[model samples]
Target: MFAPTFNLNLTLRRAVLAALLAAGSSVAMADPLHYHVEIDTSQFSGAGFLDFAFLAGNSPAPGATATLSQFSGAFGALDSKEGNVSGSAPGTLVFGNGGGYNDWFQNVSLGGRFAFDIVFGGDFLGTNGNVGTTFSLGLLDQSASAYLGNPNGNLLQFDLMPLNGALPASIAASTYASIASISAVPEASEWMMLTGGLALIGFALRRRRVAALTA
Candidate 1:
């Protein structure tokens, strides 16, 4: 009688709910990816400008290609080859004297949360005391300039230091290399929101399915 029909409706509604839940769970979002960046400068000259200057494709040199890592200020990764790279010579360095290198810009893209870590070796600081001459790693906003010493744009410079005894003859010249470990995770609230949205959608879909079946 009515009891059998009622039980049928209840079972159908439960089945619909289970189906919707399964669908939503299948589409559940995942954690963002973490990109670890390591820059290999051994092959390239110890000079940042030399490395930056001749970075394969953009360099005046022909048919060159280098792998560059990048990060976005928020929810993205920085690409070395894609983001703009530049620097200034303190007039004391051997290879980069008289502005030997021109800064180049590379556009990069990434997904999810982003940040950068930097590493350095003794060569970067060189045998000069001007260890203050820094290598930068960060996302440059549109307003930033690729030129040396612009001082007006948003750029993150990672200061370089020399290794111990790297310059036995000239202790003043300290050098270093850079390696960065990056970690990016989605915002907790964002994850919660995504889960909640999925849950709500699942509930609605199940209810609709049950209603249609019953009708």
Candidate 2:
């Protein structure tokens, strides 16, 4: 009788262990956060349209780096300028006129709002300043493929200053002015797996209790 009871307990323990492992794996499958950017050019005044823009950081004196890509929409077909940057520095890729230099007139218009998305796998909080990072926008003319300035060599830039106060200890996955951030949540499948694991653990406990009572 002792041998049978010992075996029953061992089996139940193993079931509980397996369920815990499954739940652990489910929690580990969360995705990274996504940051969104929206630029309003309706009030922007230039001979040609607002072709492209560059985003870079300035705080923590080179805080974080990221990759910028243009998502599908009105400006998707314009050109693809994707590259990496480091610590508030600028990355490669021209946002207007196929990255060609000296073609400002052919630039895209910012008469309304221009929006895009970027991803950064780094911390936003700064160690040296209240606002860890300050992002600046550089707008180039259609005639200029270069990022810093237009063909006439004039630099049109906009700075997205950091928050007035200290950076938040934690930011929720949501939208903000000119920028939006989203963090990964568990998928339905992951949630289901976790729930199933929990159920299995409960069932194992119930079975063990039944066996003990019978004994």
Local error of candidate 2 at residue 86 (angstroms) = 11
Q: What is the per-residue lDDT of model 1 for residues 30-130, given as tens digits with 9 covering 90 to 100?
A: 21222233332223221122122221122122111112234232222212322223322211111121132324333322222233322222332334332
Model 2: per-residue lDDT, tens digit, 1-215?
43356766776677667667655553231323234555554554443333333333333322343354554223422333333322211222322111212121224544555555554333333323333332334455454464323233322222222223444322223223332223333445656766776776687677778877776
Per-candidate clashes come to 36, 11
How does model 1 score by TM-score? 0.25
Task: Judge candidate 1 against the unseen true structure and give its global Cα lDDT, from 0 to 1.
Answer: 0.32
lDDT of each: 0.32, 0.40
lDDT for residue 38 in candidate 2, whole number 0-100: 56
Question: Which model scores highest in TM-score?
Answer: 2
> What is candidate 2's CA lDDT for residue 186?
47
Candidate 2 residue-wise lDDT at 73: 24
- Which runs of model 2 end up more than 4 angstroms from their true locations? 1-32, 38-63, 73-106, 110-113, 123-131, 136-215
Report the C-alpha displacement of residue 137, candidate 2, in angstroms. Answer: 4.7
